[model samples]
Target: MALGREYFEPSDGERAFAETGRSGRSRAVQLLLIAEQLSRRDGDELPTGLREDAEALGTPELRRDGSDALRGEQRARAVAGTRLRSYDAGLASELWSAARAESDPGAAIDLLGLSLEDPSPYARLSAILGLLSLAPPDGSTSGVDGYLLARLFDEQYRAPNATGGLARDLFDLLNGPPGGDVPRIGAVPPAPLGSGPLSIGVHGTFSRYGTSRVAPSHKFYGYLGEEFSPDLFPDETRFFRWSGRYSRHDRSKGARDLPLWLHSVGGVGELDTVYAHSHGGNVALSAAADGVRINFLVLLSVPPIERSLAEWAAIKQNVGYAMSLRSKLDWVILSDLVAGRTRGARDLLAAERSAGLDFPPEADVHTTAPLGWFSHSSWLDKRVWQSTTIEAEVRNKYLLTHPGSP
Candidate 1:
């Protein structure tokens, strides 16, 4: 390995990473491995510093991936993916308990997202409860899913969906019978949009959880995570006490985003990914046409909050800021209005007007693409509201079908 490293080969690093991933790997060994993997990229030679770290068996991977962005990302994903598998297989829970009780809560947080997927209900519930024990999301104690699931799973209770009208069967499973006691843990899941007449699909901030700055690696999946819970309210508190189209519908847990008939959409690999997505939805973003007003918009990732989005609020204060203008070209979206192929929410309204149709003023519909952006921005394009249905029959069916539901 030393000779290979001296020769500056990428395979040496790969081999080192694969070996250190095993259970007995030391903190130093694993850390070096993580760093090496993270700093890697296609056709690129591994850095000597990392190679030296590998040979030293120095420490566990530290902080987040960075500096050498691609490699950093690689390492983070590798570590996350490996731990994720272990947790998925039900090993991490046993180790987590030992680690957490021994004053290594930080490690516990590292493993929390993976822990949520554990097979043992206790293991999963225990992990959830453990997260709640820490600084809950915003320190609110009200809508704790750990306690809620623990209690619901224990007491046979279910939160009714205020919009869907029908409740999910998973309700009783979560709300029923007391499982053994598990300490609460975890950050609170963000609140569901509140149960108000205007809340359903209501256009608002696209970045709800601050997506950009929030490290994607940190959002790793865990047993019974906040990700599974829907915040009916925007504040990231107050559970809606009801499920809706947002959560899995038992009828079609295998399918996603009903578009009437779409088995013929080409691209076998993409189709398989959509069909196989655990969440039953496509995981990648897709669109048609180019320029300011694209034909259709389908954001595979839910419109999430990014670090850069906080500025949108500030920009929107008067018109020159980055925030989305409602319509009629506030200074922020003027380019989109004139270019007709701009970014930001107002572009959506422009798209609508182009179609010679306007939504009722009360509907409050809007778009969220940014116009004329620098190449360096973290979240260049989060969502562009532009899906179209030429068929009058299909459009009416969607709005009318969800009549009682939000």
Candidate 2:
């Protein structure tokens, strides 16, 4: 579901829903919360109210308003309580025991993994908290591991929009404040700049995909720099990887400030071209729309952006040229469409036949373009850049536009 929708925002329906303590995901979340409360203190017994809640949950029927709960409520309640007890006796107990006994990072990770995949949603949610408590500096996982866990949580739990859970809350813990655990890992510190026209490479998500050492965004930038080298001096073009906001909340505060960062980094009107992939395209588009002058904008396999063509036209007006390199075979777009986060999927799919009204009349759109063969992740692959047709297009569109370029 569109992560943009404010699930936690207050409303009458939400207030009423909270009172039940038995709403779908909400009930699961409560159980997790209670488990977290109990798990933190080494010797504390489960709270009386929480214990009763768990037992009552195990029992059966009721709409908190004294009306009959939804069908299957009793069954769900039983499942939640049973799962809670499993943690209380089995894996959760082992985790606490291991922690108190001595440092056993490996064991903790193993148990946490089991909890994460537990049959109960409540167990999964609570396991995340347990995992966080054991994270780096104090626990086994590194900063990179922490970041990956955060992404995993978002992808598995947040993406589904099940019961409007606490994905956002989890994100803050990782990325928030100085010394934040997740932000400390897999983070790409900004590269120092050089004096001259620059080829800024804007990266997409999965910043911490493999190891902390191999950042995909930075690697893509290096490849582009290698490709663009002969056309300009090494110092003339530089790559900048933009990961908007620490969290993925729509139009997050980080996104709001991106234009400022862009202007600050390259100086307004100084950047010669912008090469963006995936969600980074959104950041580039928003920056251009907000007044950063971009000469050439190349968007690769990004979802549909901009609410209207007029908005895109404004971006086009400021850029000397704009191109969208997309692939019809990339199931990533289809998956995003199903998830409801990307409208660009529609625009990209339509671009397969023609520009299909997603882009301005003058914009060049390439569908199933060889730039990225058949996958969303292929943009970083060398084979895509090796395509003769793709190489020729880049030369004509980008290098040819600049007098000194190859």
Candidate 3:
């Protein structure tokens, strides 16, 4: 059977656009709603009254702001042409300008081809939206459009921070019927016998190094078992790690499964902490939103949050404490910018200073002192594992939970 009606409810702006033909909403919101409408054939076609609205946006609307006005006009033309099923004479020039400005000339050319040569602008727009929905983070065909697409999928579609309306509808549409498209990440196989208080590491991006190689296990476990003695961790402080292959892979799937993975490997109700790096940090954040419990959360070069800071703070409080170690490394900046997630990252770090009653007391965010050497990949170095900072943090957290013994 098809999905239920509850899956698709138009937002107020969408309703306004449908009724009055104009909502004056942010162009991003308008574009998203239009894309969602164009994707489905099950609904009625655009009604008669929307023709003027479509036409209004069909041609560029230039104003005093100039460049800003031009950009808005470009987006509006695409939206209008999509809605009205046609474009004005000047579309070829505009499309060429947009293409030349694009970093991915090939993808831009393809888009231009579809926008100009396709008989139906609606179909062309739908294709653009679909590509945006399915676009990978980097590699082939990646640039501004790809970045924007990935960000849209992460921030607007998958994240809990998403406000409902047409965005939600589009997410539901592509997500498929419940239990259909999304794979059920099976529980982690049981840990070995006598698994004690655990220190789990979640790695970002699958590599030849393989899954579950959080740290050189020998370093952490060896220190606990041989160097530090058994009393602190009991049975050598169980070490576990997990990684979802390839950073490009959709994270929501692995994210949904992480809590269960934690439960399986560490045992539900097992007290422990997790150190997640890069996109692994994103997965940890997702698990936290699902109410996963841990003694502490240590994130290294975590990306930005997809939801509101208040919501993130509330989620963070579920753990004993959250310690974020951020770097001003150019790699993270360029990568996040290219990934179209710089805004989310900025918002997440800014939450540290957010004044209000809603902020959680347990949050402890740590940015590197200016010019700190840590990079997004810094955690991979064995030196970081041996560093006193990490050792102190882990030792302190253990002491806080256990209290009496050193």
Candidate 4:
């Protein structure tokens, strides 16, 4: 029987397998199914290695399904894929630059409209950021083409993809009234350190967007609990809740507030570890860069922005041990890059050709090549937390080991 099919549309046997174990071929089959789905949805060719694996494993069902998906994608691509394929890295950069440079709002809107049409997802993201930059404080995109703005709003409403909610948030930022109170920084009073080491969790953008607090039951906190089991975690675990706004201002403020919050409940010295996901990693690193000491810092799918690189030395010095876990399929980081560029920060792609160079030399970077369609938030999945790969890296390798152990 094809394990991939059973995994996707599980029968009693598949359900029994899931309850029994999640290692070896079972995990592989699941990953293959995920990869096939991603290829079908994203219109990208399946990687050769995965294709070979499917063949070797003799998963005829997966092979047939993947082949059919690829053929269907190819047919669909004939009409729309050409435009996306045409926008190479150089062309996408040029489009973004042109959009940024245009002084006239109307002309800039036109350039952004063209960028939105590009095949590259990054180019499309740049266009979204461009629109955000052009919009007035009151959130009006007046004089801009109504259809383009309507499409953006429609994406916000429908959220057809992962980035849809992000587009919605950006739209809300443009049209929503401002004047919310600034987040308090350095006001947390210092408290006594209790027994055992303390662990803190910080969430990424949109996790608590426009919200004043993150509920105790948020999935982020649950993921952290799974990552750091009760045996490893202190009795009094804390979470650093932020505005979750995807802006430089909010991130910088979060960085400053993290250290102060640490100070409030014992001090950075009392902290055992910090597990930050997505842009929350940026906040953690930024705080470390500013001389906040941490025992262990685990970054999950964090974007390697230039700002982090610039502060590499400080981060390395202050952090006892740093590890970054990223998925090969994470497009959210790419979107973060565009958002960073719109806010006038330097681009990482401009400085380094690969994601490996984004971190400091001393920091341990573990890139996971899961054979599935995982997204930015997929890192928080229970299956990911329990996987053998994650167990090796996060549990046995890092968490169980002493700080600074290789």
| Residues 1-406 of candidate 3: C-alpha lDDT, one tens digit per residue | 2223312222232232233222212222223223322222234343222222333333121111224234334444433344455533244334433433442223232332334223332223233343343232232233544333443444343333212222333333333332211354533344446766655566664322433234434354344334322422332234333434323234556666665655654454433666677667666666665556666666665654335666566566656666665443223322232222222222223322211111123345443322222134544434454543665665666566556966
Candidate 2 TM-score to native:
0.44
lDDT of 1 by residue, 121-209 (tens): 32233233323223221323333334334432442222222101111222332233422212222221222344221110111111223
Arranged by TM-score, best first: 4, 2, 3, 1
Clashing residue pairs, backbone N/CA/C < 3 A, model 2: 303-344, 304-344
Relative to the true structure, how large is the alpha-carbon lDDT of every model?
0.24, 0.42, 0.40, 0.47
Residue-level lDDT tens digits of model 4 in 218-328: 554555555453323332235466677765557678877776776655554434677777778878877777666666777777776554455677777677777776654
Better of 3 and 4 by TM-score: 4
Q: What C-alpha lDDT does candidate 4 achieve relative to the native structure?
A: 0.47
Q: How close is candidate 4 to the true structure, as a TM-score?
A: 0.54
TM-scores for all candidates: the values are 0.19, 0.44, 0.44, 0.54
Over 4 Å off, model 3: 1-66, 69-195, 206-249, 341-363, 370-374, 384-390
TM-score of candidate 1 on Cα atoms, chains taken together: 0.19
**What lDDT would candidate 1 get against the real structure?**
0.24
